[model samples]
Target: MDYSEAIAIADDVHWVGRYDPGRGLQCNAYLLHTQAGAVLIDPGSMGDFPVVFRKVLDLITPEDLRYVVVAHQDPDVVGSLPVIAEVAPEAEVVAHRETARLLEHIGLRIPIRAVPPEGGFLPLADRTLEFVATPFLHSPGAMATWDTATRSLFTGDLFGAVGAPWSLFAEGAFESQLTEWHEVYMASQQALVYSLDRLMQLDPERVCPQHGSVLVGDQVARANAHLRTLRCGIDRLVSA
Candidate 1:
C-alpha cells in the first residue's frame, strides 16, 4: 500500500492516519503534517512501519520532517525507529527520560529528548506540542502529546480498541469499543480512571490514539463522560 496515501485525516494543522486493516498487530502509525513539517508518532514496528515509512518519505522529503515523536518505546510503537532515522535524520526523537534509556539499551541511534511528567511543550512554527508523562499504563516511559493548535491529543495506546473502524471513528457504537478497550488493554481500573481524568483536564477537542480510530466530534465530552464513569466507580470502591 502507498504509505503516503495513509494520511488519514487532514485538518488545518495536521494530517493523521486512519486505521488500516492487515497493516500490523495494530493499525500502524499516525503522521502529523504541520507547517513546522511532519511528525510521525509511534511509527509501528519494523514488520509493519517500514513500508508505510517509505511511502511517507516518498510523499515528503527528509527536509520536511521536523520531528519523529515516539510517545512510548514499545516495539509496536518504536519498532521502526531505525527506518525513521534513516529517512529523516534531521528529525529528533522525543520521548520521556526513562523511555530514552530503554531505546538506547535496544541499540537505536536516534537522538532522544526527555519530556517532563507534568508535561513539557515544544514550540513548532505553526503549532505547539506538549508531552504528558503517564507511566505504567502500559510501558515505563509512556506519554501522550497534546497539540494546542488543533486541540488534538495524540494518546499512545490510551483509549484504543482492537477492532476499530477504518474511518478512525467509533462508527456504529462507541460503548462496545469502550468496553472492549477497558476489559482487554487498559492496565487497571484505577490507572485508567486517573489517566482519563488527567486527559480530561487538557480539554482536547480531538483524540488520535495509536490503535483503533480517531475520535473527532464531541470527543472531549465523550472522553470526559468515560472518565467520569470510571472515577465514580473508583469512588464507590474506595467508600466500600
Candidate 2:
C-alpha cells in the first residue's frame, strides 16, 4: 500500500494513487498540475487516502491543490472526501449535479461546482477540464473528465477492469474479467452505448479508469469498439 513514488504519465499529469493487490482490485487517482493550481481526480477510497496523499504531496502541496474532481458518488470513487477536504482545505469540488446533492446530504461542507445534465467544462488557470455525463452507466451521477492539455480522459468507472495491478498502459486484448465486471455494474445497455459513443467522439489519447490500468494507444479505440457491442444491465438480466 505504499505507493510512495508518483509516476508521471504525461505532461504535468501523475498517477499518485496506491495499487493494493491485497484487495485483488484497485483504483487510480491522478494529480494534474496546472499553471496556477492543481487538480486531483477521484481521490479514491478512505484506505487509499494516506498513500495517495503522500504520493501527491511529492508533486504539489495540499494547499496548492485547487480542485478535487469526483467522477461519481460511489464509495470507491469519493469515499475519501473528508480526508481530501482536510488536506486541500481550499480546493473546490467539481462533480455532477446529483453528486453535489449527495455530497451535501452526506454532510460534506465543501464548495461544489456542478455539471449540468448537458455537461459543462471547468476552467483552470492553465487549461480547461471538460465534464462528460454518463448517467446510469453504473452510478446515476457518473461522469468522466477530459484534460484538454493532455488529451487524457479520466473515466470514473466506465472502462474499468478487475485483476492484479497491471501495466499503467493497457496492452494486449481486453481481459475477460473487465467485460464481466461491466456486465454486472453498468445500469443499461443503452446507457453504455450512449456513453461509449460520446467518449469515442472525444478521441482521447489515453483512457484512465478508476478500477483498472490505463488504456492507451490503440487499446483506447479497441476498448470503445468492444464496449459498443457488449450488453449490460437489463440486457444481461433478460439474457440471464
Candidate 3:
C-alpha cells in the first residue's frame, strides 16, 4: 500500500503508511510539523515508505525538513534513511548514540545527531519534543519521543502489534489482537513492562507506535496494563 497518503491524527501530526492486517511487516510513520521545520519518526521499511516520503514533500518542501529522527537502528525503522537523505539532504538525522554508531558500522553514513537516552528536549514552533531512551524494549538503541505540548508519545515498537487496521485502532476483538501480536513480535516482555512503567510517568494522552494503530482514550490505559502484565510474565520466566 502507498503510505505517502497521510492520515491526519492531529493538527500538525499525520500517520503515513498502510497498517495491513495479517502482514507482519507493515508499520506506521509519523510526521511532525513545527515552525522550525518538519520531522519524521521511523520511516518504516524501504519498500513501504517511498510513497509516504514523496507525499510528505508535496505537503512540505523537502528543504523544509529539519530532522528525520530514527528511533532505532532496525531496518524496518530506519531502512529508508538513505532515501530520506537523498531527498532531504538539508535535514539532520537524529537517533540515540548507540543507534548512530550502528548505522555507521553498517556504512550508512549520514549526518546524525545523538539524543541521549535520559532525555533531550527539542524546541519546535508548535511543541517541544522530549526523547526518552527506552533500551531493550525491542532493540538496544530503541527510544521513544514525547511531544510535551500535545501529550503524545511517539513510541518506537512499544505497544505495537501486527494487523493494525488503517482505521487508527486495532480491529477485531481487542484481547485477541493484543495477545497474538504482543507475544509474537514483542520478545522482551520484561523490557516492555519496565518501559511502560516509565512511560506512564510521562502521562501521555495519545500513543503513536511504530506499528499498528494509534491508541487513545481508554485504549491507552488498557494497553498500559497489558504491557505491565507482559513484564510480569517475563519475570516469571526468569524465576522459573
Candidate 4:
C-alpha cells in the first residue's frame, strides 16, 4: 500500500490521515461509511489534505461525501475545508455553533449544521451520530462524535499522543505519551477532568483522537483513568 492508503479501523471506518515523519505528527482523519452517505471526520490540514483526500478516494469518490464533521475549529482538523467544500460542495459542514462562528470569522462561508451546547445528533441512513459537548478540554467549542453502530468515539484532541512510530491501533499502554501530550495541550486539569468524565461515560470500544493512534479494548479505559489524575496549566507548571 502507498502512503495514500486507507486502513480499516472499524466496521466501515477508514483511517485516511497521513503521517508526517518529519514533524512527528499523525494528523489523523477518518472516512466513515454510513448508510446515508460517507462522512469525513477532521479532514486535516491543507498541507496534509492531498494525501488524505487521495486515500479517501481509494474508498469513496467526492460525490459520495455527505458530511464533513468538524470536531473543533482547529486548522489541523479542518484547515483543508476550502478544498473539501469545492470538491464536495453538497457535503454539509457539521460542528458546534461556536466552531461555526469561528470558521465564519475566518471567511469560510460553507453551509453549516451547528450543534447545540448540550450537543445534538446527525441522522445517517442506518445510524444516528451522537455529538457530545466537551468544552475547553482543548478548545472552547470542542465536541466529540460517537458512532453508536461501531461504538467508536472521534475525540478532537482528548486522548491524543504526540511523536511518531505509533501504529494505527495501539498495542500497549500509551500512557506516557498520552500524559505528555495532554499536560501541554490541555487547557487546565479541571477542564480535562470534566471532559474526561463525560467521555468515559460512553465507554467507547475505540478511542480515536485527531493526532494519535486509535486506542482499543481495555486501553481506552486505562487512558481515561490515567487522564483523570493528570495535571495541566499552573499545576503542571508549578510542579515542574
Candidate 5:
C-alpha cells in the first residue's frame, strides 16, 4: 500500500494515521470534516504528529479546526496534542471529565469541553458526536465517540488489533486479531461487556478504533458478538 494519503472511510471522516512496518502496533488519527469546522479524534503521539498534521492540512486549514477530542489521556492518544495546541490554539478539546483532569496536567492551555463521566454528546453546527464512557477498557477515563450521521462508532481502543499487513478495512479474521490485543489490554469482562451492550444498542454500522483497521458492515456485528462474550484481562488470567 502507498500509505501516502488519508482515506475517507465515511462521508466526511478521513483516516489520518501513519503506518509503521517496523512496529507491530500502530495508532490512528481521524478528521471529522463538517460545514462548520473539522474535529480531530485521537491525534496519536508526537512521533506521528508531523504526518498527521500534514494530512490534516491536506483536508482543512488549522483555523477551521473546532474541536480536538482525546478519548483517553494516554500519551499515544494525547501526546501530539500539546503541539497541536500551538497550531489550533482556539480549538476546544472534548474528552471525558476524568480524562480532562489528567489532560490539563500536560500543560495544554486550550479549553477542554469535558463530557460527564457517565457519557454525553457534543453538538456541532453540522454534527453531534455521542460519547460513551468505557472505563478501564484501556484507561480509567476510556471512552468512545459515536457519529450518528454515518453510524460509525469511534471507539477509542475497543476493537484495536495488531493485524499483519494492516488494511484500512478489516476482513473475516478481524475478530481473532482484535481478540489478541484486547485480551491483554482490556480490563475485566464486565467492563468490556458493559460498553459493548451500550454500543450494540446504538447498532453501529462501522467500528473505527484508534489503533486498528476500520470494521465495516457485518464486521461491526460480528466483532461486537465476539467481544460481548469473550473474556479478557483479569477474567482471562484467572480462567486460565
Candidate 6:
C-alpha cells in the first residue's frame, strides 16, 4: 500500500495512520468522508502528525475537516489535534467528558462536545457517527467511536498490541500479541469485560484501534473472545 496515500478501509473511510519502525507502540488514525466533510479520528502524535496530515491532504483540504475525535486523552492520539483544529477551525472537538478536561491544559477553548457516557451519536448531513463511553479500560475517560454506516469501530487502547514484523492487519499469532498487550496495559479485566460487552453489542464489521493492526471479519470475534477471558492489571496479580 502507498504510505503517502490514504488507504481505503470502507466505502467512505480511509486509514491515514503511519507505520514507523522500532517503536513498540504504533498508532493508527482514520479519516471518514461525510456529507459535511472529513472527520479525523485519533490524529496521532506530533511525530506521526506529518505523515497523518499528508494522508488527510491526499483526500481533502484542511477546510473540509468537520470533526476531530480523540478516543482518549493520550498524547499519541491527541497530540496532533491542536494543529488540526488550527488548520480546520470549523472542526469540533469530540471526546468523552472525562478526557475533555485534559484538552483544556492544551488551551483548547469551549463548546467542546462531550459524547454521552452511555452512548451518543453525531449526525452530519445524512450519516451518523456514534460514541461509546469505555471509562477506565485504560483511563477514566477512555472510549470508542463507531461509524454506523460502515460498522467500523474505532477503539482507543482497548484492543491495541505491540510486536515486531507487524502487518497492517492482524495475522498469524496476532491474538497472543493482542491479548498480552491488554493484560499488561489495561487497568483490569472488569473494565475490559465491561467495554467488550458494550462493543460486542455493536457487532462491528471491522475493528479499528489506535495502537494495533485493524481486525476484520472473523478476526474481530476471535480477538474479542481472546481478550474477554484474560485477567489484567490487579486482577492478573491477585489470580497469580
Model 1: how far residue 146 lies from native, Å? 0.5
Please identify which of the two predictions, 2 or 4, would achieve the higher lDDT against the true structure. 4
Give Cα distance to truth, residue 233, candidate 6, Å.
1.5
1-240, model 5: which lDDT tens digit per residue?
A: 467688888999999998887777788899999776899999999998999999999999899998988889888898898899999977989999899988889888789888898889777767888999888887898889998788889988889987676777886577778888898899878988888888889888888999878898888888888887878888866442
Question: Candidate 2 residues 1-240, lDDT tens each?
Answer: 235588888999999878775776777899999986999999998888888888888778878999999999888878898878876888989999988888876666668888997899888877899999999978898899999999999998899887754656676776665687788889877998888888889889999998777888888888887777778877866542
Q: Candidate 5: which pairs clash?
A: none
lDDT of 3 by residue, 94-206 (tens): 88888887887655445888887676878887788888888876678888999887788998877776643445655444554556556655546667777778888988888
Clashing pairs in 6: none
Better of 2 and 3 by lDDT: 2
Residue-by-residue lDDT tens digits, candidate 1, 82-117: 877776778888888878878877665557777867
Candidate 2: where are CA atoms >4 Å away?
1-4
Q: Write the per-residue lDDT of candidate 6 for residues 100-122, one digit (tens) a residue.
A: 87777787642467876787889
**Which sections of candidate 3 miss by over 4 Å?**
1-4, 19-22, 106-109, 164-166, 231-240
Q: Rank the candidates by lDDT, best first.
A: 5, 4, 6, 2, 3, 1
Query: What are the runs in model 4 whose C-alpha is more than 4 Å off?
Result: 1-3, 237-240
Model 5 bad stretches (over 4 Å): 238-240
lDDT of 6: 0.85
State how far residue 161 of model 6 sits from its true place (Å): 1.0
- By TM-score, who's the top model here? 5
Q: Model 4: per-residue lDDT, tens digit, 186-210?
A: 8888898888788788989999999
State the displacement of the C-alpha of residue 194, model 4, in Å, after optimal TM-score superposition: 1.0
RMSD of each predicted structure: 4.1, 1.9, 2.9, 1.8, 1.6, 1.7
